[model samples]
Target: MRIGITSPVVTAVPGVHSPWERGAGIEELGAVAEAADRLGFHHLTCSEHVAVPADVAEQRGGTYWDPLATFGYLAARTRHIRFATQVLVLGYHHPLAVAKRYGTLDRISGGRLVLGLGVGSLEEEFQLLGAAFEGRGAVADDALAALRASLSRREPAHHGEHFDYAGFVVEPHAVQERVPLWIGGRTPRSLRRAVAHGDGWVPFGLPLDRLREMVGAASLPEGFEVVLSAGRPLDPSGDSDGTAKALRGVSEAGATLVSVSLAAESAGHYLEQLEALTRIADAVAAEEGAA
Candidate 1:
């Protein structure tokens, strides 16, 4: 069972670590990354959001360090831990530019990049970025196809509805001929997208029962992985077993990766919460060994 922590974004904070709080600067973010590396976290992931909605606006801070730049900083600071974006809002980025960036990060991190993607839900953000809001899903599909083609060959070519080019190749190709691509979202359409194109599924808003149902219906390829991380309520008293139960449920539902999220008030507070989760990971590891 591999265990990892969500990045120290303000969304992970309970209250006091709002984007306005300035609680964790770049330096502290680096410290948090180093701590995860030392603590045996398998992968460190960050969410991408240009703006926050009213539904989440007050609960989570409205701003975040761009995930790619932050991961580049982390890649320089850590050695073994993998770097990933929980979901990078694929439609918002040009495929060629994104391909180049991830390719560079993959090389620098020795091929430890996992590019999770989504078609984002915020129309306001789309308007802000000057992207066609209504066409995002179709554009995202095209982008994914282009990305797949661009990353497969030594010198790749692509001509798509949203993006077009020929005789184009990204230098510093990913360590893996094709880097891992995980798709996230909980709707049936999203699940279908995952089964059709994604290497993994990360549904973040479904209940355990529903998650199992979706897993059964998804009909994802054999060996295709699932990562369970719904930003829902967590039992505070579960101690170490709280995470274990979640992970066990995910495993039974066919998930191969389990991630735990910590909610706190600041970087220090979040680190304190991580200690509690680490204790759980240690206990889980012990139980597996004993069994």
Candidate 2:
């Protein structure tokens, strides 16, 4: 399995975020990214939320680094590690805007971008952004279709029920002939959408057993990725056996890409965990090779 991080301090979700993250900024973030990049980690994520409702801020993470800015900075700092937007709410931006802004990012990063998109559920935030709240799933489907046609093309055109465009040139478009798209959600419909419209599925908040059954039953295409996370933070430095076992379980549950959060109280501790995890992964690979 390819290992990645749901990067620290990028999105401070309640109960999940560490206390030290409240004070951490880009310098600390850069160090962690640089270490992961050097360690051969596959990807790192930043989530997107334009704004959260005051009442729901504590429930949904109030802190989100806009993916574009965060990834643009981190991309320059890291060479091999890919940048994944854990999700960008599909209804919030037009397909062309995503194509242009993220396309520039792809060009800048040397084609190291993965677009993870979702049909968002925050009704208040949707209204706040003046996005159409109803029938968003259909809108997202159309948007995905448009994105597929336009992501790498300079002069792209698409005609669909909800979105249509032609005669527009997107300069410095995505360098990859096909940029990876990962759909996000925890439901069956989300899985279907990923199969129908995306390259991978990034499912959150599902139990491991449920995840196993869902992925096992789906008619996934060849090389379709199931990117999954552990139920809780892992302590690779302090608890290598447990961390390794948890990572193994994630793979057994059918994750082609495994996203991990570390048990750390501070910036230094988090970097320690990254190195520890890499050592453990190397050890496991060595043993498997010997077998």
Candidate 3:
């Protein structure tokens, strides 16, 4: 099993809203990325959001660096670890622009890019980007189609309900023939989209059984990925080795990767959580090696 960590978005603010508000600064993010790389993690994911929702805006320090730029920053600092967008909201970006940006990042990072794509529910973000919030689904579908077509050929053409283009070869061709695209969302439609266009499914907020069922029902291509969130504290009843034990079950369930999020309290807390993750990763790696 591969292990990864989520990068904390940095911003200036106090306890204002959800944990999303308390993103860390760029310096902190760089340090964490370096740390993860040295400690044997295989991937690092960054979240994207234009603004925090009104209700949680203050409590959550709502600033976010453009994911592509942030990944560039990370690429300069780390080696070997793949970079990912935890979920880049499809509606907020032009598909062609995203394809170009991602392709460049993949080249800059030497083929280490994972595109985790999602639809944003934040209407404020849509209004800000001049996108129709109601059409996000259609937009995402079209974007996925465009990305696939454009990335495959020297010159590609696309004509879809929401996006249409002709005669463009996204240069700096993705270091890989295709950057691995993982669909991110927890809806039936999302599963179908993953089956049709995605190389993997990255689901959040679902229990183990539900995740298994979704994977079983989804018409995935052979070698498709299933990555589960592993940030929240597992029940403490399993003893000192419980974390490793739980990770083993997840790995046995065919999770190609597992990402653990720290309960952000302070730098110390975050680092402590990362240390715990290192131990778990070591255990999991050993199990996989033995297998």
Of the candidates shown, which would achieve the greatest lDDT relative to the real structure?
2
Instruction: Give all candidate RMSDs, comma-separated.
Output: 3.2, 1.2, 3.7
Per-residue accuracy of model 2 over 9-83 as CA lDDT, tens digit each: 998888788899999999999999999999999999999899898888978779999899999999989999999
Q: Identify the candidate with maximal TM-score.
A: 2
Error of 3 at 94 (Å): 1.8
For model 3, which pairs clash?
9-23, 9-24, 10-23, 10-24, 16-59, 17-59, 17-60, 21-60, 21-61
**By TM-score: ranked, best first:** 2, 1, 3
Candidate 1 clashes between residue pairs 3 or more apart in a chain or in different chains? none
lDDT for residue 283 in candidate 2, whole number 0-100: 76
Q: How far off is residue 85 in model 2, in Å? A: 0.5
Task: Supply the TM-score for candidate 3.
Answer: 0.84
> Candidate 2 — which residues are off by over 4 angstroms?
286-291
Against the reference, the lDDT scores of all candidates come to 0.74, 0.92, 0.74
- Residues 121-164 of candidate 1 have per-residue lDDT tens digits of 88878888887889788998888888888763557688888888
Give stretches of model 3 more than 4 Å off. Answer: 10-24, 58-61, 152-154, 233-242, 252-254, 263-276, 285-291
For model 3, what is the error of residue 221's alpha carbon versus the real structure, in angstroms, after optimal superposition?
1.6
Compute each candidate's TM-score over C-alphas. Answer: 0.86, 0.97, 0.84
